[model samples]
Target: MSSIKEVSLRRATVADAEAIAAVRVEAWQTTYRDMIPDTYLDQMRVEDSFLHWKQILQALPAAGDRVCVYVAESEGHIIGFASGMLLPEAKFGMQAELTAIYLRPAWQRSGIGRRMVQKVARTLQAQGAESLLVWVISGNAIARNFYEELGGVLLHEQAFSWDGMDLKEVGYGWRDLSVLMASVNAMPTSSSVH
Candidate 1:
């Protein structure tokens, strides 16, 4: 069995776009197998996702932009990634949004996700963000429970349209960055390779 000591997290660079996209596609295929339409999932291509992420990561951050991307790795191989930004629209006073997070199936439930999120939160807080929010597909109970376990509170719900299908999305909010930062800091650092 793989241990957390084998994993490390760091800022993602442009060269990582392809690996990040691959993980995104694979994770979506696995996690959203029944939650999303087969047609939509079938059309998800790594090349397309690579181009999208490359463009996003290549763009220069504007003034006050706190956009960041972090990748989790084990023995130099990318396993998971997360991206976030400080959004203008605030919900429950959360100015930061977790735009995307994905991990290969084999890497899930190993504390990597929590570490990645905490790192993102710390980066956002340093950029002057006070709170953060994440939106998950309503039926994705695994994600919902993960957020809840991290002390997130249900903030709101909205209708999302994808491939002509209407879907419900639930938003989870963390009103205090300090609380999250402290919790992350309290975790045993020895297990983290980085």
Candidate 2:
């Protein structure tokens, strides 16, 4: 395992699609193994992930949504990643949802995840978001704790179908984007008023 001290965060590019895919696959297996079906994971293919990553990197976000991808690199190799996007909503204000965040098992607990998340948050704030959001698997204590430690609050609980099975997900929200940004060493500013 590479040393976490070497990890640094930066904006991802279309050229880094493959590296992002690898980190996604690793995080999925480790983070969602229990939440998702074993059969689904067993049949997962790197090619599919490659295609997905390419698409996300190549396309622009739709409607009210915007995406920003951040990668953590160590010695020129991507070791972790996070993707944040604005969500379409009617009642809530502009929200930056942490669609994905993952670090290699060995890199976990090394502040790499926090750094990756901060990159996304800062990017979103720059894009004009006032709040950030994340949904953790109901049973994922590690993720729940991580979000809480970062000052996220449980907003609601919802169940969704994935791979033909019911899955429980709990929404955790950051009421103050400024507070969340502060934890990441960011000096927060209000996004553009629309």
Candidate 3:
């Protein structure tokens, strides 16, 4: 097995949009291969995704809005990214949502994802968000397990259509930011892949 390298997490910038988008697309292709339709995955274009991310990264937040994007870097290359914002309409009583988190396949299960989530949680908490929620593709067992391991509680499920196919999403919620924060903090700092 290849050894994991140290990863540094930092706020994402406009310049990082392309890399972030690439990571997102690659992750989707790998993680959702069986869960999503092949045509949809095949049509996912990096340029389109890059433009979307660029717009999101460049947009100015409205009053009372709390949006953050972060990227994980190792050996001077971006390996993953995560983004979150305060939810306008709280779901499951959660004030914030983890909009997205994606890592390259090789870098997964290396403790980088947990660190990204913890950092996003702390950022959200600082913005006055008391609780957090994340939506995962219902059939994605790996993702579901990852959230559960991080203390997420299954709160709800919703149906949606993708590429003419019906799909479901599972919502995972943390009712208290403090509990999540404390648990993340309790982990040894050395546990980081670095």
Candidate 4:
């Protein structure tokens, strides 16, 4: 495994689609293995998400839309990533939301996730967003704890269906970008927001 010191974060491009898809699939399989049905996770494939990420990276955001995608790389391999946007309507009175964040299981707790999140938060904050929120499947204690450690406040929780199974998800919101920014900044570096 590569050390965090070798990892770097930057905005993603279309060429990264395949690698990003791999990371996404791997992350889902590993992170949600227990929470989600085995059939769903087992059926996931990198090919399935490749075109979607390709389009996402290639398309230009429409007028007044703010979208950001960042990736964490080390040894030329994409290890983790995050995507977020300025919300058209506020949830928990926050103007931005972290739509997705995932890291290879090996990279977890390496501070790469912190740096990736910082990039996303800073990017949205620059786009005139004052606050942000992320949804965590309620049973995902690891993720919920990570968000809480970053000063996230529980804003909402609701029932959601997945593969015809009932599940719960909770929202963790940061009311102020500065607070989120500062909290991550204060932590030891070697990282990303993922």
Candidate 5:
């Protein structure tokens, strides 16, 4: 981490759709290479992601599944992003499902991912989400460790099929979103570089 002075987190705009899509595609390749099929990754279309992000950006704030996307910008470029939504049937009163979280491959271990996830927790709590939950491919040891180090608990493991392969995913959860927030908020702000 370079100790950047300013890393801004702001609500994503429609203009950010293309950038967001690029981040997703790149992150997916770096983070899910072995977990997902190359065929699936190969077929991923930026057009699809553009359309998806466009819809998300255009939705009214009150729309139930309308995700609140946040981008972490440094030096006029987006290094990471996070997306989350309220889960209606959550075991906890108001739980948020973290749909996606990704940082550029070059930015890993720079604490940007940690900051983004913490921001997501605070954003979700403000929206009445009492808990936070994330799904990770079971084989992804790196991601599992990251969440665990961030105070997430290994809740359960479930099996599903993806790309015609049997895949098992692990669920990591924060029963109290505040806990997650505290961990993120307590971080040294001096980590960000300008």
Candidate 6:
């Protein structure tokens, strides 16, 4: 078992697309099991998403742009990632969006998620963002609780369809980027490595 202490995070590059895609696909399957349609998860392929990830990484943020992606790695393999972006207009009064954040099931609750989120928060804060928001499946209690623990407030819920499955996504917002960043920084990543 790898300890959270073994993880290292850094900005992701185009070369990391495949590994990042793999993590996303795997995490979605593991984390969203009954919470989502099995067909949606079953059809997810790292290879199929490889180009999508490549395009995201290939598109470098222009001047004044806030889009960013960070990857968490251990043993030279990418284990997780967190990505965020700033749209041209604010939605739900939040300029920054936590576009995506996923980790292997085994990696959750080990402090790596906090570390990845901190990187995203710092990126958004540096880009003059006052706050950020993330959308999580309404049925994902674990993810919702994690965001709540980090000072996110339940802002709203929007109904959407995924692979023909009706679902509600809850919006979690942090009104202050600094508060989120500070709270994440204050967390102990458990230095005792096993």
Give the candidate number with the greatest lDDT: 4
Instruction: Note the Cα lDDT for every prediction shown.
Output: 0.85, 0.76, 0.85, 0.87, 0.78, 0.85
Q: Model 5, range 1-194, lDDT digits (tens) per residue? A: 44454677777887888888888888887788877888888888778888988888778355633367888787788777888877767743337888788877877777778777877677777777778889999999999998887788988899988757788998999988778877766666545532
Query: Whole-model lDDT for model 3 versus the true structure?
Result: 0.85
> What are the per-residue Cα lDDT tens digits for candidate 4 across 1-194?
34545787888888999999999999989888789999999999999899999998887355234998999988788998998998889887989999889988988888888888889898999889999999999989999999988999998999998768899999999999899888887887544333
What is the TM-score of each predicted model, taking all chains together? 0.90, 0.86, 0.91, 0.92, 0.86, 0.92
Runs with alpha carbons beyond 4 Å of true place in candidate 4: 61-65, 190-194
Summarize candidate 6's per-residue lDDT along 41-148 as a digit string, tens digits: 998899988999999888854523579998988878888899998757988899899999998877788888888888888888888889999999999999999999
RMSD versus native structure for model 5: 2.8
- What TM-score should be assigned to candidate 6? 0.92
In model 5, which range of ten residues has the least summed lDDT? 185-194
Once fitted onto the true fold, the runs of candidate 1 whose alpha carbons sit more than 4 angstroms away are 1-5, 60-65, 183-191
Candidate 5, residue 85: the lDDT equals 79
lDDT of 2 by residue, 64-121 (tens): 2378887877778888888888776612343678889988777777666776777788
Sliding window of 10 residues with minimal summed lDDT for model 1: 184-193
For residues 85-107, could you state the per-residue lDDT of candidate 1 as single tens digits?
88878866889999899989887
Residue pairs with clashing backbones, model 6: none
- Candidate 5 displacement at residue 176 in angstroms: 1.4
Query: What ranges in model 3 sit over 4 Å off?
Result: 1-4, 60-65, 186-194
Taking all chains together, the TM-score of candidate 2 against the true structure is: 0.86
Q: lDDT winner between 4 and 6, please give it.
A: 4
Q: Each candidate: RMSD to true structure?
A: 2.2, 5.7, 2.2, 2.3, 2.8, 2.3
